[model samples]
Target: MSEEKERQAANEWKVGPVAFISLLVAILFFSGLFMKIDGMKWLSAFDFTTLGGTFGTMKEPAKNTFLGAGGVSAKAGFLFALSLVPTVMLALGCLEIFSHYGAIRAAHKLLTPFLKPLLGIPGLTGLALITDLQSTDAGAALSKELYDQKQITKKELVIMGAWQYSGAGLINNYFAIGSALFAALTAPVIIPLVLMFVLKFVGALFVRFVLNVVYKEDFRNEQ
Candidate 1:
């Protein structure tokens, strides 16, 4: 091969060390392999049943026999929020690694074409947005990491957060928690999930308009 050709081949972009690290982090996170690791087991130690029981068992303040409204509310709030702590911590840690390792930048260029028009955010945001549809805490945590890194502007943050709030946990919420309603009804489960997912994007458009035009926030620095 010619010298010039050899130089081009050597410099041509291929998966690098950072990309490998980022890929490993992503796989560990999404596959729940991190949770299985001995050192990381505490991250998944939270008990959903116990958290739910706190609210289920809560009652109005009564005489000495009852813990009262204050106690009930305190326990409920603490447990509910505590259940999400693991997700937030895990996502933040994994995303920081991904960001430092160049995963976000590698994904940005390819995703920009599609995500920009629909969400007014960079392509890198897709990972969090998709994860949100399964787990809201993890998604929000990832978005926060992006915002902190200044990869996304304030406007993009708000728009994406709104999208996530609307239907980010669709699969889990509908198939698991929402199964009570979906199973009892005659309607196909896909109907509500699909409807909610579409509406989420629609809501993103409105939010983008409000932030971009109404508020006049600049999101031109997306990276």
Candidate 2:
């Protein structure tokens, strides 16, 4: 490749050692892998669930959760959202630190190449995809902005939407909402989250393939 092309390629995939290290640290901290290591109980300091702590069990007959014990309506929904604030803030705060050291940039570099083959989308759309893990609304807004800016076609938006809609706000939602059911789960915390994330890819790819084949003529100009 030419010198200029080489430089551009280098820039495209640039992830410094510190950024990569930060990513690894963030993973280890949140993975729940070190929360119970025999004599190293202090490792809970690095664990998310351990540090985010648990809510008091509901004792108002049957005991499902602390959220009004299976209560319904807008009031119950508001309380449920209120309960999630602390954990979400704690998780996002730690993520912000990692991001300050460039974890997001590192993730973007590693994830960009898969966009085209996996989701039939541009590499630049990686941010919106990653953002969905934290906040569905932000990710949706970003995706819409991309479409409005003509960076991604309508077909690409639909495929991306399929991906996000399936698990929407995966990380935060899983930790905030799904964590309530963790007591009944036999598998570790990370396992189900991993499955959900993998399914997002599977779902998006299916949409992309359908768009290319069954709806081929509609996206004829997109190619």
Cα lDDT listed for each candidate? 0.68, 0.75
Worst 10 residues of 1 by lDDT: 46-55
**Regions more than 4 Å wrong, model 1:** 1-70, 73-76, 97-102, 184-187, 217-223
lDDT tens readout by residue for model 1, 1-223: 6999988855543447776567545544453323334665565433221122222333533532234434466676777677778667766666676766766655564567988988888878876876686677778888887788777888889989989999666765676678778657777768877889899999999988887777773655543
Give me the displacement of residue 16 in model 2, in angstroms.
1.4
| RMSD for each of the candidates | 7.9, 6.7
Clashes of 2: 0
Best by lDDT: 2
Candidate 2 lDDT over residue span 129-163, tens digit each: 76677566556766786688786899989999999
